[model samples]
Target: MTEPAAYLPVLQTGRWFAHLPPDFAQPLLAMAHLRQLAPGEVLFLRGDAPCGLYAVVRGAINISGTGGRADEARAAMLTRLEPPHWFGEISVFDNSARTHDAHAAEASTLLQIPHEPLQAWLTAHPQHWHALALLLTDKLRTAFVAIEELALLPAGQRLARRLVMMAEGYGQWTAEGQSRRVIGISQEQLSLMLAISRQTTNQILKDLEARALVRVHRGEVEILDLAALRATCY
Candidate 1:
């Protein structure tokens, strides 16, 4: 794989990587190689042994699975992660098999920093492991927020909040000034992320559309009003 000269900004602008001390950040960036995937390609599967870290460079990654608990789309699918989002770290930290499936939601480009080299680098600079821990905690907080929403919110509210989160890139993207007017997710993927059925998703989206909060398009949802979308969350 060739070095992606154009992809560094996507990583550099993200909170986690941007804050890393130069000594730690420079070498890691140098070691990364590109992994390209065709649409629908499986990047890794549940139970697959740890491989490495991945950062979305161009397209989206469909993250799904239930750790052998359930296979239904609602129960299985997690979130769709887009550019600037880095994943595949839990296994690298714990040396466990992958806990979920990561597939290419579309033709995608990922930056892969292999496990062996990364582990060696961390061992030599143990303090930098805290950096990785920060990454984990960032995700943990997002997961906790999602769990709380699922427990206390209605389906429509939950869906609204999820959209807001995606548009915000769960905090990984807000700094980049990325155009988020349109969220590039299909209805099926959106429904799965919310653990709701397609019919319900469509109906709720239509309800939002009727209210002029959003404009639904083919395979995408345009936010007619970001403030309104955030307001709907609460």
Candidate 2:
């Protein structure tokens, strides 16, 4: 049998895998399957069987909900998952159809483990139950934050919060101390995630840029004042 390392880096770094009971490791590792996805490719659709969870190994994945009109502003949030981030987990736990569609935001590698084997392994390793519970708890917290953003925040505020969140979550230092360069993500994509019209999103971006809080480049967005940007998260 191929070892875990022989499959992909994602399974090796997954929080769920890392926290699994020692006894469950070998079995879980043995069943891991790896696949590479091209940019713009769909890993799985929303209604696919709630099989194994997926761990991102390289590149990014965007998770979007199903059943939204293209122009209705259903607010398809882009998760921007990095290595070790798991998706499709809720479906795996609940044994329901996948509630969201996951796609490669860039050329990516992923590890998938079948639900049947994972569940069987979990059954024998009751010690892992607490870890699973904690994982679910974190997911719930994030979901609540998303709900709050959608329900309470105005369009500009929602957009501001997302920019700050993305910058804090993914930006790298630019040696200017105050300036940090964010990864290449288009405004259209951000607009889709924010569930606002492209014109509205563009206007918000301009306003932030004018305030000297951010700088939008060809594809990258640079943070000039983290504190000021965060303050806009009202």
Highest TM-score against the true fold, candidate: 1
Whole-model lDDT, candidate 2? 0.71
lDDT values of the candidates? 0.86, 0.71
Candidate 2 residue spans exceeding 4 A from truth: 1-30, 68-75, 170-180
Global Cα lDDT for candidate 1: 0.86
Q: What TM-scores do the predictions have?
A: 0.93, 0.79
List model 1 lDDT by residue over 1-234, tens digit each.
357656878888788888989998887888788899999999999899888998998899988976433554335578888888899889979999999999998999999999889998889889998989999999999999989988999999999988888887888863654547889887888888888899999999999999998999998999888888889887
Give me the runs in candidate 1 sitting further than 4 Å from their true place. Answer: 66-75, 174-179
Task: Name the top lDDT candidate.
Answer: 1
* Candidate 2 lDDT, 2-66, residue by residue in tens: 44466444454455556566666666557778778999898877788877867677788888774
Q: In candidate 1, how many Å is residue 95 off?
A: 0.5
